[model samples]
Target chain A: MRYEEYNLEDLFLLAKKGDGTAFEHIVRQTEKQIYNLSLSIVKSNEDAEDLTQETYLRLWRSLPDYKGESAKSYIFRIARNLSIDLIRKRNRTPGSDTVILTADGEFERDIVDHDPDIRPDEAFIRRLTIETVRECISALPPPMRELIVMRDIDGLAYHEIASILEIPEGSVKSRLFRARERLRALIIEKNIL
Target chain B: MSKHSCKKYDFMIDDYIDGLLSDDDVRKLEAHLSTCEDCRQSLRFSIALRNMTRSAALEFPVGLHERIIESVNEDKKAKNVGSKRKIFRLGAISAACMLLCLCCTAVFLMLPGNRKSESKLPPDCPMSEAATDPSAMLPSFNGSVNAPEKGEDEGYTYPVIEEPALSSPEYDENSPEDAAPTPDETCAEPEEVAPNDKNDYEYSSTDAPANPAPDVMTNNSNISDRLENAADAEKSETHPVASPEGVPSARPGGEEITLALLIVSGLLAVASFIAFLISLSSIRTHSSNKENKK
Candidate 1:
């Protein structure tokens, strides 16, 4: 069954009874989405794991107060807040081996058009493309990284992305389109497409 | 016109995919998409990309679900444990305080009536424990020399007697002051006169008295020896120039007991002060950490 079909109250009702099995089911069901959301912010497995745990723990504690209808959104809200907090905390610690993505207005744009289908050893090329795409995403500035992740990976609507990121919907569309165009250019330049 | 006018609908394509448009807006978007090739191609790629992303979302580490559940359980257990510990600590502190209060009450009950008055010595101190010849004075229940013995020097005069065994010459050689007759001398004598009357006698330094001063005579020779020993106690008086400063000096056994008690009390005070400082620092540090956590 789709996780979204199961309302939060059902999970919360079972969880409040000190039911570990219910908690496990909840965690297993939400773990992928939560992990992906965390990874998009922290960009590290360990940090994502930590944020996911924090998100789950918060959800567990807040289950008693949950009104049930908006449970999925509630969990997402928790995950979002936790991810942001983890990022802020990471920035505050001194001597931390932080990887900061510095944004620059002097963006070098490349426009390229490649054939939609150029099957060049599907397995190897797909692996290399995936790795290179990850590297390119890592290289992007904070704004661009977030824009690309929201639009491409999470597949959020421009309005939803804008709301999540606290930017104008117009800004979200433009940035996402630009980010995609840039990724396409990099793929062509790196000869991965 | 349909092909050329559809460019405006491209911008709303993302909103339409997200299901945010009204029914009328959806009908308009569908009417535009039915003829716009470029818009349709863009929507197809966007949909494919969205599908790929949904399909490619990474799974978490195998045991993370179980681990999260374990952590939640552990956190609750730890909270319960912490609350129990807090209650236990409060109980322990209350028990300790009660015990301490009981002990202080017991100590107060055991103390003599005049404890506060005895704590402060005279501002102008004339004597220390080292200078006082304790063996000469009578026993006192408390350490203070200002307080009189339980009985006032009941009507009596103790006489001074010379000792033949330890001649004055040999005694003077051993002690710079004139020799006091040994305990055996005055222990045998008796006196019935009051102590105040004997205080009026001009103590004669000479050995002979033709009048045979009966007022100066006491049957207890040991008591006379005690008086003569106290005669050398002029310098050790805590307050000099008093009419009867010779009273309340320590006897041999009383001096030993008071000295031991003073030493033990001093050590206890020092240890308690050190422990109090350590506990204060620990509490301060703990409170600071709590503030930082907040």
Candidate 2:
């Protein structure tokens, strides 16, 4: 059976027992989500890549002590915490912000067109390119940006986001709503339509 | 574009976008959206935002996987080396402590005060017998002039005087060239007599003859009077005398040095054993880790 078919908890248990293959499988499964979470928070490809590697290293060391119910939340929590720490350290040192870039050093050119049957204004909203959307998201306040990334970009459930953020689920919903509203306002202010 | 006047549906827009609205709420939102062009634009923006963000998930950098794996392996190797070094350091410390303890033990055993014979007194000594027998009265000296008697009502115990051995060549009986002189013939020179010497002479005066020359008696009486005055002035002070068991007389400071060394050795041995145990446990852990890797 493919390693992805194995239960995450089972994979974690095997990894705890010093199974290198199982651990690698876990890394492969969670690396994209961890990377995206890091990138969204730190906003720099290089720093995000480093944070992703660091998250895995911390996971390997702390695996034996993990008793949490969700392995996915545990991994994402590690990435989030590391990204926050890096941001705090950067804030202490003046002139530390480096140029940010996507992994391929350029934005994706082909935009996915929206269906007009659902909303009559769908084609009008599609005028805002993916790059423009990313710029708008990056311009958001850190709390709003984090909420949007975890909820919309990474597609984590509200409860999972709450668990990762150590907040109540109701707070997650309110904050996420505000983040989405802010994002929509930013896109509208861009006058792309 | 005009702002939507339907303020009541602002919160439901997100629930509707997330597919969380009930059938009834959806119908109400749809009915309101049909008349509200501004709200329809807001819904389109939310959908576009969600789509673009989801599509914007960053790709993992090429070769980062291999690098991460390599870094993990390197970290593991570094940790193993670090633990091994720690164990070696502990083992070295344990060995050094054990060596020091052995050296201290050797020095302690060689000390003069630690000799078995020197720690005890000669059995033939009268003072030793008196000291050993707690109920025994102090031995009276026949030649002690005006020896204080044991007063029944007085709680004071008289101090014991030890005679200096007359083993010098000048007093040797076997050498005719150095024949021992009679007590009267051995007149001390007035110029050579120190103030302290008078006290010694007074203590030994009881051994003298009952009838002696008037000049000698007068001189001895003068010396005895001076000695009595000095003793009275210092009556409040008591000096520590050598014990009859020869415990204090066995090489000054030797026993103390031996005891200090013994205590030091004992502490060092304990520390060394503790370090050794720590190193042994670390070794076992390291081996177990290697076994798991295998």
Q: Interface RMSD (C-alpha) of each candidate?
A: 6.9, 4.1
DockQ of candidate 1, scored on C-alphas against the true complex (2 decimals): 0.22
Best-fitting candidate, scored by TM-score: 2
Estimate, for each residue in A1-193, the C-alpha lDDT of model 1 and write its tens digit.
5434655557666676555556667776667777877777677888888888888888777776766544445666688778778878776331222334325332344324333333223333344435556665655544455566666676555666655655577766766655654554454456543
Off by over 4 Å in 1: A1-6, A9-22, A57-193, B1-7, B97-294
Docking model 2 quality class: acceptable
State the TM-score for model 1.
0.44
Angstrom error of the Cα, residue B168, model 2: value is: 37
Cα lDDT listed for each candidate: 0.55, 0.65
lDDT of model 1 at position A154: 60
Kindly report the docking quality category of candidate 1. incorrect
lDDT of 2 by residue, A1-193 (tens): 6667898888988787667778899888778888888877888899989998999999988987988478888888999999989988887221222333245322223222222223336665757688877887877656567778888877788889989988788878876766666666666666544
